[model samples]
Target: MNDKKEIRNILLLVFVIIIVGALIIAKFYGNNQKERYNISVIAGEAHAERWVVLQQGLEKAGNDYNAQINFYTVVNGKDAREQKDLINRELEKKVDAIIVCAVDSQEIQEVLQKSERRTPVILIETDLKPGHLYSQVSPDNYEMGYHLGEEFVRQQEGKETTAGILIDNDKIAAQQERLKGFEEALASAKNITIKWRASDYQSNERVDNIIGMDCVGTQNATEISKVNNEKISIYGFGNAEANIYYMDKGIIKALVVPNDFNMGYLSVQNAVQAVEKDMVYKNTIVEYIVVTGDTLHNEENQRIIFPLVQ
Candidate 1:
């Protein structure tokens, strides 16, 4: 009788243990299978060629992290008002997070700040004015500009040269920083002087060199150089297809290419992290590379300039 009672108690304990273990395993698996997060991205330019690589990076991250990305762009070019309106619309829908390449830092600062209180916000390419509420994932604009300036100075054979700067929008905070760094770099070399700074090309103005502060500015300068059959040396930022074509044709002297793929991938990855893990976001500086006509076809540079089709 005693042996039978002992055996019954042991079986009862084993059954309870099995049931508890099953419950714990189910709970753990359920936690691991989190629902996919929804993230929204608003780029400064809707049709910029550089976005191709960036969008790929974003999509890769989204796939890796189980996120659904909704990309938005300004239909009427780079307009701060349009960006604000988009932000409001996203907020109304209550997205999990927002990633924006601001058109005008000042114009969208307040709206972004308010939006951050309710949703996670991330900045790309440029950051807002000081004391911003969100984090940025971009190349060091000032440093990039400075390096481009240094490259320009290196190209000089100790001859006096006049350079004109073309920028898409002076209001863009990234452009402003790049412009500052370029100017400061030029300041050290008295031989090179900035003849004029304009948003659009000046047909009447002539200069030995033209420096584009953004991809649009670069493409504009390249097109102007090709059309006018001018002998001006063009140097600017971006790895756009147009830029590459011009560089191959020797119309563009050099380019400062940013890791746009990393920018896109990290932005999405960071956004997902901010939502799931409550991670404290901070500035994540991506890398950049300088490509000249001589080095454009090199294996390493090609990897940076051209995105791999996966």
Candidate 2:
């Protein structure tokens, strides 16, 4: 009887020791693994060209930092109501953070402000009217416009030139800023006559130069110039593959390409920092490049022009 009791006690002690050892190993691994975060991105439009590059950046950063990105967009770029609804839905779903491209700066300001109370909010491209956004990632629209204007000035070489400017009619702040900066650059140039027109307008006015203020505008101007067979010099902003193709074919004379991939990657990176380290809000103005036919294939620009995800 004594021998049987001793044997049972020994077996029970061994089982407890094995169970405790298993739990200690499990705890060590659990502590070593970093917690993955859920991040949501709300874009102005679905399948927009700019967003394509930006999405690549976002995905790359998400992979590097162990984040799950939930990307959402409205069918219409200017649909503020839909954007508001989407923001509400994401908030209810309890996403860790939100990165938004405001369709109407004013219309969505209140919603964004409210959402910020619950989670960290970062703006991409367009910012709010009151400028209350704690953080934003975008290119300097004014600088880009000014740079394109400078390129035009260089090409014209102070010769008298007739030019038409094409810009989006959405009246977003970014577009407006681009227009303002371009106009300011041209303000001191006495040899150019400016004809301002909305992107939707189709006019037969033959001009020596055509300028577009954004990706869609650039593509539209390029198409119009091609279809009309107008002997015109084209300059605009964007890094769409189509724009690059046009540049290669000499259809686009000058292109202002914003680093949208950086925009995407940095915005998410900032959001993650805000969540984990309680980082303060900051505005990160991404870089841009002015590429001409002659300089398009340079090694520095090629990386941005043809981004490869590793």
Candidate 3:
């Protein structure tokens, strides 16, 4: 009887040990499966509000897909060389995929050509020339600009109109496309004249009748209006806090806002697909909406404008 009891105790101990070992193995395998992807996202400007939302979207998608994401930001104002170095570093690290918001599409062409064949390359908010990239995710800049132009014409209401356009930079593809569309939209309007168009945002410059082409331009127009105690009819791109503040005060007339959260989310989703499934990604264009002071508070508009919180 004593021998039999001792043997039973030994058997119980063996059973416990086996169960624990099996649990450990399962946990290890689950963790390994969870970390199957390593996606790298590189942005042109780190401090920008739009980029912040983009990063939020990326994090959300990463969590949903059980993938790891490493994000890099370009400081010191959109330096192409800095972006190129970051891309090369990620390439050397052998990251599963790379997402880039190129500062100068032309300048980064060589590095992309070298690294794209090895790893999937995704472009966000910008595009390179010759157009044969792995993928591109951005808003329809031309359509946004054309919509703003249409609003400007509506504001004029058949009256002779004179306006100045404050462009962000003509060299940027997004900005160039926007400007082209705006011009094309206004081509038939003989009564409206563009008095001055420039990239610089001068606080001392006239803002009485101005069409700001971007966030910086809109801010400059607002500051000029504040200094001069004048109400300027400003229309531009972006949904920054300051832009909304000016809109509330009735200083800014209209805005063309991009769905940046979707841009970021889709970029990463496509990147993961490219790496894991060998998927081919085409141009993924994010949608935009026009907002004015009267329509800013609408529920649908608020959702797009404040995507991170939602």
- Per-model TM-score versus the true fold: 0.88, 0.91, 0.85
Instruction: Show pairs that collide, candidate 3.
Output: none
TM-score pick, better of 2 and 3: 2
Tell me the spans in candidate 2 whose CA falls farther than 4 Å from its real position: 1-10, 114-116, 128-133
Q: What number of backbone clashes does candidate 3 have, counting pairs of residues 3 or more apart or in separate chains?
A: 0
RMSD of each: 3.7, 2.3, 3.3
lDDT per residue as tens, model 2, 1-310: 9999999999999999999999999999999887898999998867777778889999999999899999999998778899999988988888888888887877667776665455777888774543433488888888988888888888888899988888764557788888888888888899999865666546547788788888878888888878888777788988888888888988789998888888999989988987886656778889989999999999888878667732
lDDT of each: 0.86, 0.83, 0.78
* Model 3 root-mean-square deviation: 3.3
Candidate closest to the true structure, highest lDDT:
1
Task: Indicate the TM-score of model 2.
Answer: 0.91
Give the winner by TM-score: 2
TM-score of 1: 0.88
Name the better of 1 and 2 by lDDT: 1
Q: Give the TM-score of candidate 3.
A: 0.85
Better of 1 and 3 by TM-score: 1
Quote the lDDT for 2 in model 3: 100
User: What is the per-residue lDDT of model 1 for residues 121-233, given as tens digits with 9 covering 90 to 100?
Assistant: 88898765433346789999999999998889998967998989998898899999999998888887988878889988865489988999998899999888888888989
